[model samples]
Target: MKNLVILGAGTAGTMMANHLVSKLPKKDWKIHIVDQFKTHYYQPGFLFLPFDIYTEEQVKKVGKKFIPKGVNYIQQRIEKIDAENNLVDLENGTLSYDILIIATGSKIAPDEVEGMMSEEWKKSIFDFYTYEGALALRNKLRDWQGGKLVVHITEMPIKCPVAPLEFAFLADSYFKKKKIRDKVEITYVTPLSGAFTKEFCSKSLGYLLEEKNIKLVTDFAIERVDFENNKIIDYIDKEVGYDLLVTVPTNMGDEVIERSCLGDDLNFVPTHPNTLQSLENENIFVIGDATNVPASKAGSVAHFQAETLTDNILLYIDNKPLKEEFDGHANCFIETGNNKALLIDFNYKQEPVTGTFPFSGIGPLKLLKESIFNHWGKLAFRWIYWNMLLKGISIPFVSRNMSLKGKNINN
Candidate 1:
C-alpha cells in the first residue's frame, strides 16, 4: 500500500488528514500522522485566557480525538527529515512515505531574543502565545496595580497576527472594567510602520488605538530586552519601559525543517505561493505557519489552504497538474472591546476593504467596521472550529479563493 505521512497534528495537519482520508481510497493508500504532543490547544483562546474569558478546559482537547480513525496517529518527536530518501527519522523509529506533508507549524522562540528568556520571563515579562504563558500572565494581572503595560511584538509572521492587537484592546477593556483605566498606561509596540501589515487595516486599527488611549510605537525593531531595568531596547538604543511586558517573541518553524535544510532564514519552508507546494520538493506540501508564504499565519489561512492543498495532493498522485490555487484568503475578527469586534476579509491582491462579506450590500458581518454581531460571530467560531473545521467540512459561501463580489474596491 502507498504510505502518506503528515507531520504535526496541529490545525493544518489534522484538517489535511481528515480531508485526504475521506478522499483517498483505503484499498490503495494508508495515512499516518505524527505529532509530539497529546493535547491540541485552541491557540486563539490563549488570547482570552489572561483576561479570564476562556477557561483551560475550553482551549484544550486530545490531539487524537480530532484525528480521523482511518489515519494512524503516531505521537513522537521528529528527529529529522531525509528528503533525499523520502523518509522521516523519529526519535523511536523511521517512517517512509510516498508523499509527505509538513505542517509542523511555527513556535515562539523567546530565547532567540537577547535577554528575553531571562529571569524576568514569566515574572514580569510574559507572553500569551502559549498556555503556560497565558496562565502566568493571568496570575500577574490578577493584582497588577496600574502601571505601564507594554504589549510588544518581537517580529512579524507570528501566528494570528491580530492577536497582540486584540490583547491590547482587551487589556484596555479589562482595566476599564476594573476601574483602573486611568491609572494604567497601555502601549503597543511593533516593528512595522503601522498597526498592521495592510495600510487600510493599519489606519483603521491605529484610530482605535488612539481613541482607546493606547500609545502606538511603530518601526521599533527590538534589539534586546533589559529585564533588570524592565525595558526593551531597539536598534538605536531607544528603550520602552514597562512594569509588565506582554510580548510575542520571534516565531520560527520546527527544527526538523532546519535540520533537513528545507527552510529559509526563519526556518519557514519556502513554498509556491499559489500551489502550496514546497519549492524544493514538489512531492511535499506545506500549509499554515510552516510555509514562507506572504500571508497571515492565522487559523483561517490554514483552513483555506487545506482546501486547495488537498486538491493539489490528489492531482499530484494522479500525475495531473494542480488546478487550484490559494489566494492567501484570510478573514480575521479583531476584538475591539466592549462587546464589539471588527471583521476583515482579503486575499493576496486585495487589502482589507470596507464592505459586507459573503453577499453584496447586505451582510450579517461587516468588513472594517465594528459591531456586536461580529463579536458574537467571533465567539461562535470556537464551536465551528471543534465541530466543523477539524472535520474538514467545507464552510458554505467561503471559498478557497477570495471573492471580491462583496468588497468595496473603491476603498
Candidate 2:
C-alpha cells in the first residue's frame, strides 16, 4: 500500500483529508493525518467570543470527529521532516510516506516581540487569536470600565487579516451596548500604510474607522512593548499608550518547517503561487497558512485552495501535469458595529470591487458594501463550516477559482 502522510489536522488538513479519502481508492492508498491537538477550534468565532456573541461550546469540537473513517488520525507533536527520505519524525516515531502534505498552519508568536509575553500579558495585554487568549480577553472586557483600548497588528500575513479591524469595530458596538462608549477610546495601529493591504478596501475601511471615531495609526511597525508603562513603541520611537492592548503578534509557520529547511524567513513553506506545489519538492503539496502564497491566510482561502490542491495531488500521483491553479481567491466578512457587516471578494489579479456576488445584480450578498443580510451570512457560516465545508462538500455558486462575473470592474 502506498502511504500518504498529512501533517496538521487543522482546517486545511482536515478538509483535504476528507476530499482525498473519498476520491482515492482504499485498496491502493493509505492516508495518515497527524496533529498535536485533539480539539478543533472554530478560529473565527474567537472574534465574537469577547463580545459574548458565541460561547465556548459553539467554537470547539473533537478534531478526530471531522476526520473521515478511512484516514488514520494520529494526535502527536511533529519533531521534524526528513524530506530526503520522505519521512516525518514524530515525538514517538517516524512515518514514511509516498507523498506528503504540509498544512500545519500559522500561529501567533507573542515572544517575537519584546515584553509581549511579560508579566502583564493577561492582565493588560491580551491576544484574541487563540482560544485561551479569547477567553481571557472576554473576562478582561467584562470588568474594563473604560480606557484606551488599542487594537494593534504586529505585522501583515496574520490569519484572518481583517480580524483586528473587526475587533475594533465590534469593540465600538460592545462598549455602546454596555453603556461605556463615552468612556472608552479605541485606536487601530497597523504596520501597513492604510487600514488594509488592498487599496480600495482600505479606503472604505479607513472611512469606517473615521466614522466610528477610532484612531488609525498606519505604517507603525512595532519595535517593542512597554508593559510597565502600558505603551507600545514603534520602530521610529512613536509610542501609543493604552489601558488595555489587544494585539495580533507576528504570525509564523510551524517550527517543523524551519527545521526541515523548506520554508521562508517566516517559516512559511515556499510554494508555487498557482499550483500549490512546494517549490523545493514535487511530491510535496502545501495549503492554507503554511504556504508563502500572497493570499489572505483566512479559512475561506483554505477552503478554496483545498479543492484545487486535492485535484493537483491526484494528478501528481498519476504522473500527470498539475492543471488546476489557485488564483489567490479570498472572500471575507467584515463585521462592523450595530448588526451590520461588509463583504469583499477578490483574487490575485483584482482587488475587491463594489457589486453583487455569485450573480451580477442578483446577489443575496453584496461586495464591499455593508448590509444586515451580510451580517446574517457571516453568522450562518459557522453552521456551514461545521456541517458542509469540512466534509468536502462544495458550496453552491462558489467555484474553486474566483469569478469576476458579478464584480464591478470600474471600481
lDDT of candidate 2 over 166-247, digit per residue (tens): 9999999999999999999999999998988899888766689888999999999999999999999988899999999999
State the lDDT of candidate 1 residue by residue for 277-328, as single tens digits. 9998878999999999999999889999999999999999999999648999
C-alpha positional error of residue 255 in candidate 1 after TM-score superposition, expressed in Å = 1.0
- The TM-scores, one per candidate, come to 0.99, 0.99
Model 2: lDDT of residue 9: 94
Cα lDDT, all candidates: 0.93, 0.93
The C-alpha RMSD in Å for every predicted model, in order, reads 0.8, 0.8
True lDDT of residue 115, candidate 1 = 97
| Model 1 clash tally, residue pairs | 0
